[model samples]
Target: MSFDEMDVESIWMDGEFVEWDEAQIHVLTHGLHYGTGVFEGIRCYDTAKGPAIFRWDEHIERLYDSAKPYDMEIPYDKEELTEATLELIRREGLESCYIRPIAYYGYGMLGLNPSDCDEEVAIAAWPWGAYLGEDALENGVDVAISSWRKYASSQIPTNAKTTGTYINSVLASLEAESNGYVEAIVLNKEGNVAEGPGENLFIVRDGELYTPGLAESILDGITRQSVIEIAEDLGYTVHDDATISRGELYTADELFFTGTAAEVTPIRSVDDNQIGSGTKGPITDQIQTKFFEIVEEQPEEYEHWFMPVEQ
Candidate 1:
């Protein structure tokens, strides 16, 4: 849904809470011009206990780490950002929502270098449903191999969630959607499967799980890591470092994409070629089921993954 359609009211900017409409930045902002910013997408689930953020600590750590490559330093510490996010949700009375924490260079000189610009940070939360669509989680989404290839880490820090690098994803997504596919599977420079436009890809074969490794020019997605652990704990052999080829996607028994937004969505087809039964496979269902269960129920076994909003 669009922000205008939501009932959100406040946004945490820098160290203060500002009215949602008041949260604005100049067009001359360095990050806006040069994409010299880092951001994180996180989820807060409405669990049995109440609203709780999933894996918030890890997300915060990654947000900071993403800034390292650009020499940008976030002004707020982890605790401060955490508190700001929690308070923002509480103020908005959001039981379940998607959180976006962004740090970027503020308005200053227009040169390619941002040495003189100040760093600006903001956190916003709003209700969001399944990214691909609610039906996508059940029936699976159809995808196509993008004509566009994912850029190599050598050219850019593929692991970092840089704002500018997403033009590659924009192109791939546009290509797939224009061709009538729900999503796109991007390939690396080597013609190996990298990941989805905004998610990590996992292929299941012979009841085992496989995903592209960090070296495959994919982001180290938090949900990707969580799913890896969840699949392993369920007695499935996972090849985390496996390099997947385009041909392998069509031949896989099942396929899925994982990320903060996509969560665990099954990919039913690639290039219109049906995978397995052309629907959510058994293994994919099991992992997706467990993932929702953990987020909604907040079971003690995985309690460490949740950070209660009330606390």
Candidate 2:
């Protein structure tokens, strides 16, 4: 869904707020031409205390981490980026919205080498409902095993959320949508289950939970880390590293996806095979419930994960 002009009027560009429609880069921007950039999708929730950003420091750290490989130096320090993001959210008066922090190479030299290009950063926040669909949160979504294989870390830094690498994701996701499924479950170069387009995959069987590790060409998602912790806290053994075959998904007791956008979305079916009971399973509900509690209510125990922003 596109944001209305009224929904997001102000955008933080480099250290100043500008009209949302005015935040633009030259057509020859290096990142636009060659896709040399890094970005982070963070969520701010309307918790009881106020509008708090989830894993604020972690996202900022990852933002820097994402830029490191490209040799892109974000001019501003982490503190500046963090403050800019918070101020942008406050300025927009958005209580619950998706926050995007992107650092890209700006126009300078049109040559293939972006080493001499300038690193530009911007932050924007606006209300975005469930990424898949509103019903997808509870009823779950059907996804196809994309013909597109995730690039190996050796080919590119799959661990980093580089913008260029997402072309592979785009192809996979487009294939799924064109084929009528809600999303795509992409496999890695080695034919092992990697993850969804923008989310990590978790499989449940025998009451134990499992997800592919960084070795599987999957991102080190903060939400994935939270789900592992929440599941373990509930006395469930969660394996951070697991080699999941495409066939394993069809027979799993329950399957779900985790990420900043998807949150805790259950996967009801893959290739039309009903996963478990074909609805959100017991363990999935338990984990999702606890995860939501932390984000929405700002539970006292998990307060450290949230950074409160003055509304």
Writing each residue's lDDT as its tens digit, candidate 1 over 1-311 gives: 78789899999998999999999999999999889999999999999989999999999999999999999989999999999999999999999999999999999898888989999999999999999999999999999999999999999999899999999999999999999999999999999999999999999999999999999999999999999999999999999999998999999999999999999999999998999999999999999999999999999999999999998
Q: Which stretches of candidate 1 lie over 4 Å from their true place?
A: none
What tens digits encode model 2's per-residue C-alpha lDDT throughout 133-205? 8799989999899999999999898878988889998999899999999999999999999999999999999
Q: What's model 2's lDDT at 118?
A: 88
TM-score of each: 0.99, 0.98
Clashes of 1: 0
State model 1's lDDT.
0.95
Q: Local error of candidate 2 at 35, Å?
A: 0.6
User: For this target, which candidate reaches the highest lDDT against the unseen true structure?
Assistant: 1
- Each model's lDDT: 0.95, 0.91
Q: What's the number of clashes in each of the models? A: 0, 0
